[model samples]
Target: MTAFFFALVASFLAATGARDQLLVAGLRARLGPAPGLLVVALASAVATAFLASWFGAQLSQGMSRDASTMFVALAMLLAAFECIWPNRTPRPQEPTRSLGAIAIVLFLRQLTDASRFLVAAFAVALASPTLAGLGGAIGGGAAVAIGWAAGDALESKVPLRKLRLGLGLILAVLAVWVGLTARGLIG
Candidate 1:
């Protein structure tokens, strides 16, 4: 349980740090204020936790070290690509910024975030299905809240370039960590 808890927390932190900047940027651009940003962030966390927990359990049942490593690598590479070659087109304007729309946007954003999946996988592996679900929800919710607060506060203060660099570094580190774990370098 202790090990699982540590892994869950570590993985969550890693994933959140890796994607925070991009998430914040999107929120800032789309929503444009601290309150709206918070709503989106909270919605994202809840949606991610639910989705991750549901999928993580299914994946964990048949997951292997090699497969996990490959998945992680692919995710890292994809994240790198997104950071280096982001789609510059402005987000499609939504006709209505309703609560439902906000929910959909938040859920979609989290669904695309690889770190959430990684954390879910870790949680599922470390604990039973029930625990995995709970852990994912808790972790995802906390991460989203934290990311939202940080993003809202630092949106104007920090430069995008620096955020990208930091995200890239974190993704690289996570990729290495996943590789090492797959190779049995770490337990």
Candidate 2:
């Protein structure tokens, strides 16, 4: 389906250099490859994507097509800003190495990340929350799996900050164009 493929690609692109993916990669670097940890990451991503898509579906029930488009554009703008912003939160000293703690942290990060927002927006736009959610889950899961497999190599070999900045700028431009079209200012 169009919705599925679109969300899959968008979520995958959005997940690059995301905080959740970075955190998992960092943990893998420190702890070595752990299948259990990858499972946790996948579960968290799936849950976040599903929740967001569901919320988007609910939101779409009451909104007009233009309103949904406008809202999706706004979400894209927020994600762009997040990607462009420097992460200022200092890494906290780990009080515990529990998998539960890791899962909680990963879940929280994914809940607020760009990919989830995109998943939600796509769900609203496409009117197919289930497909959008599944696509987003798979894409986001793949990103986390890559992080797990690559370990420290990801950080060393890739320019994550630069990649994210580029993504941010692209998303911002797309958002503006979408917003303008939604407002009938341009098509």
Candidate 3:
């Protein structure tokens, strides 16, 4: 059950990742549906999910269920906050920010994603972080592929505000659910 929810949310959030849209849109414009770009994006997703999940699994060591639940709840809250807050500017780029290659950029971008945190939390919660990562990798790949396919009309057609609101609401609910389960209020 945890894995299912983790994968569903991970895929949705990853596909709709705010940072990724601009890059994808830019690539679409610059490359015109180039296969190489899509391949890179897919590979990046796999690598990103693998690393994120493994890190989460390691963090889960010695963590009690209640503690894990608390952490997940906190992460979900953070993700909700991200959705509620208006987008902010990136800090002035250190030279480290100027990496080349779409694949590498995409992989690096996942490092700081709220979506990855959710995957990590879910993995720890279910005691299946690596499995959760596998699901996340699949979801991430699918999201990028679908979003890239629709990149051309994404701006005019996609209702981002509504989508964010909906996803945020779901995350909020999950936070509550985790809290309840932690407190022994739910199964």
User: What is the C-alpha lDDT profile of model 1 across 111-167, one tens digit per residue?
Assistant: 756445555555455535455545555666666665555644544565545655566
Which tens-of-lDDT digit does each residue in 76-104 have in candidate 2? Answer: 99889888987665444452467899899
**Pick by TM-score: 2 or 3, better one:** 2
- lDDT per model vs. reference: 0.56, 0.88, 0.69
Ten residues in sequence with the least summed lDDT for candidate 1: 86-95
Off by over 4 Å in 2: 88-95
Tens digit per residue, CA lDDT, model 3, 87-185 = 453422231222246667777766566566677777777888777888878777777776578765665687765676677787788888878888889
- On TM-score, the stronger of 1 and 2 is 2
Clashing pairs in 2: none
Error of 3 at 133 (Å): 0.6
> What's model 2's lDDT at 92?
44
Best by lDDT: 2
